[model samples]
Target: MHHLVQSSLMRKKSMASSLPKIIRHRELHGEARQLNRMTCRVRLDQLECPYLVEISGVKRLLDITRECIFIGLSNDSRYAVGLLYSFSDSHHSSSMGHDEDEAELNVIVFELSATLLRPVKILIFCYIFYTFFLYIY
Candidate 1:
C-alpha cells in the first residue's frame, strides 16, 4: 500500500510539469551561427492571431521562411500578441579598420515547409498587415 501511494505521488508530479515550454528570448554569438547552418521552426494556429509558436535550431537550409516579427489577435478580441526579434551587435578585434572590421549579425531566420491550417494563415495575414501599419504610421 505504501509503494502504491508513492507511485501515485510520483505520477502526479510528472503530470504537473506538462505545460507547454515558453521561450522568452534567445541569443547567438559569433561563430555560433557558423558552427551549424541551423533553421528556426515555428508552429502557430491559423485562426488565432498571436498564436503561440516555437523556434528551434535546425541543421538544413530551405526556401520557405518566416519574418522576424509575428503578430496575431487573441481569441478574446481585446488584445494582440507580437512576437518580435531584438537585435544585438558583438564586436571582435581585427587589424582591418572600420568597413573591414565590421561583422554583420544576421537576424534569427527560419524556413517553413509544412502546410499551415486556415487558422494559421489568417493569423499570419493579420500579423503582416499589423506590421505594415506600424511601418507606415
Candidate 2:
C-alpha cells in the first residue's frame, strides 16, 4: 500500500511537468467573440482559437485608435496579445496616425496550462508517425 501511494505521487508530479501535446503560433487578421450577457456584452479583440478564458465584471470604456494584434490563442484563462502601439494609459487620436519611426510591438502572457489522460492517445500517434518515418526511409 505504501509503495502504491509513492508511485501515485510520482505519477502526479510527472503529469504536472509534462509538455503540451501541440502548439501553434502568432497568426494575424481575425476576430473571435465568446461573451457573457452582462459585462462583456460589447465583444472586441482579434483573438483566434483561444483556449480556457474567463473574464468578468469589466469597467471603463475607451476607443483604441491603434491596433492590438492577437499574438496567440488564450489557454487556461491567459490570452497572448501583441500591442502595435505605444504603451500609454491615455487614449489615442485617430488623426495622430501611424508613424514608422515610433512604431512598437510587444507580447503579453498571463496564464496557460494543459493536461492529457493516459498514454493510449500518444502511443497511437507515435505508431503512425513511426510508420510514416519508416516508409520515408
Candidate 3:
C-alpha cells in the first residue's frame, strides 16, 4: 500500500511539472450559435480536422475584426495543440456589400490537458509544392 501511494505521488508530480504554467496565442473560430453551444466547432476552410477541446485552461478569448479570433492558451494548452497535425478551420468570413453588410463568423473552444497521451510530430515538408499550389489556384 505504501509503495502504491509513493508511485501515485510520483506520477502526479511528473504530470504537474511537465506542463507549462501558462500558454499564449491560441485562436479557435466557428459558427456563432454553435460556438456558444459547443466547445468545439469548425468554420475555417484552411485546416484539416476537428477536435474536442476544453477551454478552461485558456486564459483569454477574443473575437477579432470578424475576420480572425485571438486565443491565449496556457502552457499546457499549447502543448496539447502542438501535438496535433492540424487544427480544424476555426473561422472564416465573407462580405455581401459595401457599407451595408456584416460578415458572419464562428467561435471554437478547446480542451487542454496537463499531460500528453500521445505525442505526434508534424512537419510541413513541401514549401515549394505549397507555393506552386498557391500560384496555380
Candidate 4:
C-alpha cells in the first residue's frame, strides 16, 4: 500500500488538470436586458459539459452540474449514499422564477452510474419546498 502522502500526490497529479469547475452562484436575466452571465469560467477550457466524467482532461466538464455536498458510505463500504443539490437543471425544467414559488424548487437526486464514476439520475424531485417539509414533519 502506498503511504497517505504518496497516494495524495499521485491523485493530485492525475487530477490536477482534471479538477472540476464549480459555479457558486447564478442569476437569471430579464427579457428587457441580458448582462449577467457566466463569470466563473475556469481556464476557458472547461467547456460546458452535460454529464460527469471520470477523467475530464479530454472532455469538457458541465458548466452546471449537480453539487454533492455530503456523502455517506456503509461501514463495509459496500453501499454508498450522497446528497446532491444543484440548480443546473433549472434552465431546462422551466424559467427560474424571480421568487421561491416560481422557481419550482428545481431539485434532482443522482446515483453513481454503473461505471462508478459518473452520476445517474435516480430521482427528480418536483415539489413545493416549504410545503414538502411540512408534510414530512
Candidate 5:
C-alpha cells in the first residue's frame, strides 16, 4: 500500500508538470465589456452581390471589388470602409492550403460609427479546415 501511494503521487506530479501553464488576466478600463458588445452581423444580400454587415446596429454594405473588400456608408461614397484579410505570418507555408497547417486568419474590420472614427478591430479566426472539410464532404 505504501509503494502504490508513492507511485501515484509521483505520477500525479509528473502529469501536472507536463501540462502547459495558463495565464489569466482581466481587461483594464472596461475595454473587455466594450469589446464584447461590439458585434457584427454578416449576410449575403444576393447572389454575386456584396455582403451586408451590420456593425454596431448600423447597416453597412460591403463589396469585394478587388483583393480586399470595401464598404460605403451613407452619402459619402468616397470615404469607403475596407476589410483586408491577411495571414498572421507571411513566411508560413502549408500543404494544400489547409487551415491546420496555416496560421490564424486575420480580418481587419474598419468602420465609421457616428461622427467620430472608431478604432480598427482585428478579428482572428483559427480555422481547423481538415475537420471541417472532412465532415462536410
Candidate 6:
C-alpha cells in the first residue's frame, strides 16, 4: 500500500511538471481558442453575431446589440456559454422606432462535447434571457 501511494504521488508530480504554465490572459485565451477550434471545428470568429434565433414552438429573434462575450466553461468544460445584450422588436418600421432602444441581457450556452462516435460537433443548449429592465433616470 505504501509503495502504491508513493508511485501515485510520483506520477502526479511528473504529470503536473509536464504541463505547460500559462501566465498571461492572452496566452490562456489563445490556448483555449485553439483547443476549441481543434476539438469543436468551429472557430470563435463565427460566434460574433448581431442576432440569434430561439427555436421553441415558435421562432423568436434575439437581437444582439454588441459583440458576443465569452462567459466561461460549463459542465466540466464540456461546454461554453456567451453573454450578449439583445432586444426583441416585433414591429417593423421604416423610421426610428420605440423598440429600437429596448434590449435584454441573455446568456447563450453551447455544447462543446466532441467525440469520435458523435456525429454532431457543436449544439446550442439554451438561451437564458433576463427580463430585468434597465431604464435611465
Residue 136 shift from truth in candidate 1, angstroms: 42
Compose the digit string of candidate 1's lDDT tens values, residues 1-137.
99999999987544433112111111122111111221224344422222244322223321122433434333222223334332222331222222322333222222221332112221221111112344554
Estimate candidate 4's RMSD in Å. Answer: 17.9
Looking at model 6, residue 84 earns an lDDT score of 54
What are the per-residue Cα lDDT tens digits for candidate 4 across 26-128? Answer: 1122112112332322432243325643321224353333443335433322234444433334554454443343222222333322123233433434444
lDDT of 2 by residue, 29-134 (tens): 2323222321221134331223332211122221221233435444422243333333322234233442323323333342332321111110001011122344
Winner on TM-score between 1 and 3 is 1
Off by over 4 Å in 4: 1-66, 88-116, 130-137
lDDT of each: 0.29, 0.30, 0.30, 0.34, 0.38, 0.42
Worst 10 residues of 4 by lDDT: 22-31
Residues 1-137 of candidate 3 have per-residue lDDT tens digits of 99999999987544433222221112233211111121222222322323333222222322222323334433334432221122222241123121222222223333443222222322232111122344554
- Candidate 5 versus truth, CA RMSD in Å, comes to 20.9
Output the worst ten-in-a-row residue range by lDDT, candidate 5: 18-27
TM-score of 5: 0.25
* C-alpha TM-score for every candidate: 0.22, 0.25, 0.19, 0.28, 0.25, 0.34
Q: Residue-wise lDDT of candidate 5 within 31-137, one digit each (tens)?
A: 11112121222222221435565432335664534435555332321123445554433333343344434445445444332222332554555644343445555
Which is the better candidate, 3 or 6, if ranked by lDDT? 6
- Model 6 residue 7 lDDT score: 100
Candidate closest to the true structure, highest TM-score: 6
Q: Model 1, 106: alpha-carbon shift in Å?
A: 16
Q: Is candidate 1 or candidate 5 better by lDDT?
A: 5
Residue 130, model 6, lDDT: 46
Best by lDDT: 6
Lowest-sum lDDT 10-residue window in model 1: 18-27
